[model samples]
Target: MDSQSRVFAAILTESGREYTGNENPQRLKVQAVDRQILNNRVQEVQVTGTAEDCCPADRVSVRVSVGHSKDSVNEVTNSVSRRLEYILQVVRQHGASEKDTSVRRFLHREADKYHMDAEVLITFSDFEKMERVRSVLLEKLAKSVCVGTPQFYHSAECLSLMRRRACVSAVENAQQKACEVSQLLGQTLGHPFLVREEETREWKNEDEEDGGRCQNATRLPHPSQIPTITVSSQVSVSFTFRDISKKKPQ
Candidate 1:
């Protein structure tokens, strides 16, 4: 073949096609240029951002128990019943609903006397009300009633809200950084092209580096003072860039 035909054949082979002088030989070059232009059309900036949010424990559970041993089963039942009724009443009076309170009993005979023990598990939403209930039970029943320490924790809804807030804050921080970078590059910031949560972590605030246990404390920590749950989120975001010179000023 001629020199021109040979060159065309070589280009066709490189493009993974059979040489066809009848067709446009420059088609492959045109397609390559188009691809380069398309690749340069949208420039992107990738940045990582991190943020944390903390929420105090929103629920507390307390357990109260009473037990009595008497000569007969009826005597034991009546004695335990009185204390149980009183405990339930105090809990209800403090705004706790029946659904939030659960009761369990154990009855048995040892040697000759019969024994009965009852427990009331209460979940409280209001710390002050729980304190009042605890105080009344202790003052009225005294040592007869055993009130367990309150356990504080975050509710499911509270945790869900905290996680969302942390993730959104992280994304916002990433966008802010991307905007600054684009400005430095003399480009306008466009809409985000990609967003991904790279990592997430949750732990008690007490585990923080700056936090430490208080030794020789005078009083126990209050319900509200309980260690809060801290959630942190790290996100990777890619934002498109627009030419500042081509943008119309608002």
Candidate 2:
């Protein structure tokens, strides 16, 4: 071939590889790399939030005890039995079933005189009923019956509800924070891409430990004063970023 013809042929051969099928695999590889880079550019925001709340007790228990001393064993036994029976009858009449009541009795000699002591523990779901039973026993029996103060506590259902409330509150706080941050960044907040409960804690109100001036304790928070349980939760949430222009009209 002539020199000019040879130069033109060399140029054609050098540029031909780009259109040939042999370069297809390399082109596909470059496109795959570009897709990976685009995936890495996807925007997301992560935030953490925490919340705490208190739950009131739902059940109460009361204890009643009676004791008597006499010169003879028969006298002490009869006296104690009569009072014990009366107490049990009063408890049963106040909406308390056999399953809700427990009884214990003791008979012994102290200083040559026979002595007897009996106790009844009653569980009440209705606070009104518990108060009524306590009042009646103290009124009719006078100093002969000793009625203890009410002890309040939370039931399983109450505890479950409290836990759910705390967790949901934490999640809501996180979502609110994410929305505000997204607005500041000129982006719209999108649906949550990931949600996780990072931690949870629970404790009883301890006013006594803090010199009786804690926030949850204006007064002494004993079992008789409707003690409260505090529950706290922390959550981490990740949300995808959306375009502000694409946000729905409000």
Tens digit per residue, CA lDDT, model 2, 1-250: 0000000000012322223233433343222223333334556677888888787777877778889999999999999999989999988888799998999989989998999988888888887888888878878988887787666778888888988988888888888777877777556778887888888889886432322111211122345457688888888888887644334768
Cα-based lDDT for every prediction? 0.74, 0.71
Clashes of 2: 0
**Backbone-clash count (model 1):** 0
Clashing pairs in 2: none
**Model 1 weakest 10-residue run by lDDT:** 1-10
Each model's TM-score, in the order given?
0.76, 0.67
Query: Any runs in candidate 1 off by more than 4 Å, and if so which?
Result: 1-39, 207-225, 243-250
Q: Residue 230 error for model 2, in Å?
A: 2.6
At residue 96, what lDDT does model 1 achieve? 98
Report model 1's TM-score to 2 decimal places: 0.76
Compared to the true structure, candidate 2 yields what TM-score? Answer: 0.67
